[model samples]
Target: MKKWQLQDIRIRDPFFLKENGEYYLYGTTDVNTWEGNGEGFDCYRSKDLKLFQGPYPVFRAPQNFWADRNFWAPEVWKYRGRYYMIASFKAEGRCRGVQVLISDDPRGPFVPVTDGPVTPTDWECLDGTLCFEDDGVYMVFCHEWIQTGDGCICAAKMSGDLTKLTGEPEVLFHASEAEWPVIHREFDSEGFVTDGPFLFRDENSRLHMIWSSYGEKGYAVGISHAQKGVIGKWNHERNTVLEKEGGHGMIFEGPEGRTLLVVHTPNTWLKERVKLYSVEKLILGG
Candidate 1:
């Protein structure tokens, strides 16, 4: 059997799930994520979160799928006694968008639940995550600044069956709206690239979101809180949560009932590695 090490896996947009006494890690596993056409998403399973097993082929691209490359950020969750995945994909000319996938198991050959991407057909977006609030399901995703030069995170309500969008997506915030998010490339012309947006509510009922962006220092994680418990009314925090060239983080519980944060560190294609951090109890000030 092949041994598992953090360096061995070339992944982006790392996500974690604790189920049945085990930790399952999922992400974009294309060997050539930065260039060239790529393969489908894969996952790894571990107990201690240090050693992983299998580059398990959970979801494989169909023969003539519309989005043949740039398959990224596959986040799975258990809902209604079934497994659902919100993942990003790209095609020949269309911009990246999130689509839903369904599976009977966590380690799945997740099949598409949507006819096509869920984000607006005219908008460029990526890194979609499912958020349940006020008895409704919402798909929160990032509108690629690559196209607009001002990336923004937005959310749209999903239909009951999770097969389609229920309403128009609402603009939550822009990459430039956050005090910590900055533009990295001065040459490319696009102001900033806002990547992943993961949502979670803390024990005190404070809704927080962690998203990725390149700042004055480097690529880092910026956090924001929802002042009124509404998804779109988030106010930016002055300080970033994790600022050491790491991002695309999501919070999950460990087997020991501890909250943990999973994100890819060194945020560059050549130096990225999956890292886990213990979530400390902290209070959010309004």
Candidate 2:
């Protein structure tokens, strides 16, 4: 068996699931994702986070799939005894949008649950993540700034079957809204770039979010908290949660019950690597 290494995968927007003492990783796989020709998503399983096995082709593009390429960030979650995936994709002349897929297992042959992308058809969106609340399941995603001068994060309620959007998206926050989100060299004449929004609940029963933005130091992760446990009123933390060349993070508890943050490090396409960090409980003091 070939020793599992990160080099084997040219992946971006990585997500993980810990199941039955094994870690299953799924991500956008393509030779060059920046040019956006990703075929589909794949899965890798590892007992120790290192030494992965199987580049199992979990999903293949459907014949009439609206998005032909740029398949990104396939995140799977166990909901109602089934597996659900929220992934980002792009079509020939359309902006990148997040879509939902369903499967029977973590390492799955996932199929689209909805007709097409769940994000607003008129707006550019990406990095959609599933967040459950008292009302129902919500699709929290980034409204790409590439199309708009200012990038924003928004959330919308999904229908009971999780097959379609139920209401208008509520703007949670904006890239310019965060004190820590910064723009490096102007890309496309716009000064802001926003990506990846993952929802996590800390030990204190507080709702928190971790998202990515570019800065002088390269891609970085910023943390924000919902004071009232609602999506619309997120308050950005003054300090970044993780500033070392990494972003697009997701939180999961390991077998030992330790919260771990998984993200791609060295942000650039040429040097990206899957990195994990043990999350420490942050105590806020006046």
**Which candidate tops lDDT?**
1
Question: Any idea how many clashes model 2 has?
Answer: 0
Best by TM-score: 1
lDDT (10s digit) by residue, model 2, range 52-119:
88888889888888887777888998889888988988888887788889999887899998778878
lDDT, candidate 1, 32-77, per-residue tens: 7755775788888888877888888989887767687888899998
Models, CA RMSD each? 2.1, 2.2
Candidate 2 wrong stretches, greater than 4 Å: 6-10, 184-187, 281-286
Q: How close to the true structure is residue 52 of candidate 1, measured as C-alpha lDDT?
A: 86
Q: What are the Cα lDDT values of the candidates?
A: 0.81, 0.81
lDDT of 1 at 92: 76
Off by over 4 Å in 1: 6-8, 281-286
Q: Determine which window of 10 residues in candidate 2 has minimal summed lDDT.
A: 277-286
